[model samples]
Target: MEQARRVEADVDSCDPCLSVSHLSLRFGAGCPSCMAPDAALERNVCPVCGTVHAVRDVSFDVYPGEIVGIVGESGSGKSSLMKCIYFDQDASEGDVRALPFDGGAGNILDLSSQHKRRVRNTVFGMVYQNPYLGLRMDFSSLSNIAEQMIASGERRVDAMCERGYELLGEVNIPARRAKDAPALFSGGMQQRVQIAKALSNNPPILLLDEVTTGLDLSVQASVLDLILRIRRDYGVGMVVVSHDLGVIRMLADRTLVMLDGRVVERGLTDQILEDPQHPYTQQLVYSLI
Candidate 1:
């Protein structure tokens, strides 16, 4: 009898425009020889060294309008992977191929810095783990959101401000507070402001790096609900990097489980949660419970 071949998930649903293949990244290589001995050795020496790998050879495709969760413990390389996909960091090896709006083929990694900035400004947006990092402490919430639209070349200050106020209202922040800096708001309110900023340009893909960290349980739940609503309303593809299984269950259609810098499992959210096959995944599920 012939051995059975493992079946892969259908690629039909994956966006033809976004493709990532055999991605890998490592640190310590950038250290100069004069600054550090064994710099060459450090190049290949695992920073995590038999522990975590930061981001091992990983590959995945994200379809337009799909919500994918990248879940792992701290140091599992969830954030690093998102950084690479978002073009914030260069991958040591592999390819991130994307199609331009004009139907030109482009490699995100190979784009010139200027082009990369253009893509980031107009084509992609990100939400940081800390809401304060996304805002200007010296500026009002309305101005913070409008600034992003301006940077992305929206050009008309009046229009940006009008749209900014509309987004603030959309995220449920009161118009009265629009003139206040995010510092004056509670954690949840600040997060709402961050969401408004991230959505200002209507980017097709939104990379959210632990958007609900450090909040109380109720606040976290509310933020997650708001995120889900934004996903439906905007129809944007989202990659949510989080350690919280509850949040993943609420938002992700598919989940990728990372352990010590490697992807240990990938499957539907409920299936993997219920019947995880990898030992590391089992431990993660147990820890969640």
Candidate 2:
């Protein structure tokens, strides 16, 4: 069984807003890679050939107003874990449950395709690393946000536009540019718009995958600040995946460190940085300094 440890910290004592238990995903029938603890594979798979354990027995929880950061290098399966929760990718095993979901503790993975789509729109919001993936570049920013509202079952043009205009302003985008296409916005502005769209439905949980992967330093700071404010003011739970430790430190209340598709360490952000228990974490911390 995978462990979800709540080490020393000031985490909320309330029930978890989202719970992921013993989640494991493997691609391909036969994989032979360095991830095998021994030649005897309990999961009976490796990281080589066609098979890859994108996420291995990973488990964690996020409270109503907490941020959980997953830090790892590219291909370390951090993003995969996020996707599984958001239902972007199906897990090979294990289950995920979220509060406010009608199914209660039922595994969302087993939900029908239509119900899954409903969950994506109403229960969770996802901000992909690429704005292009999250936004409709050809559509105006207002419409981009309105589209989400429509999917979430909102009707009435005036109400949708009102929410759209409000979201644009909330993301720091000038209200005057609400009608402008996303292509006309800078990368930073586009990312801001993406955030606005992600929050349009006011979902309880937000999944941010490498949200600051490509951007100028100043723009990155602005986005990070916006996220901080949202959590501070709105009490939204978030799962943030990033390769940059600094980004994780700034946004996450708790951090999970992964290597080769497995979480080797997890704890309060300060503890992980100051007293890394794993050798890989030690090297990563020193490299940051």
Give per-candidate clash totals: 1, 2
lDDT of 2: 0.85
**Could you tell me which residue pairs clash in candidate 2?**
32-48, 33-47
| Tens-digit per-residue lDDT, 139-188, candidate 1 | 99989988888888888878988998899999999899999999889988
Q: What is the lDDT of residue 169 in candidate 1?
A: 95
Tens digits of lDDT, candidate 2, 182-257: 9999999998999999999999888999988889999999999999998977888999999999999888878999
Candidate 1 residue pairs in backbone clash: 15-63
Candidate 2 runs further than 4 Å off: 1-12, 30-50
What's the lDDT for residue 236 in model 2? 89
Q: Among all windows of ten consecutive residues in candidate 2, which has the lowest summed lDDT?
A: 1-10
User: How many residue-pair clashes does candidate 2 contain?
Assistant: 2
RMSD of each: 6.0, 4.2
TM-score of 1: 0.85
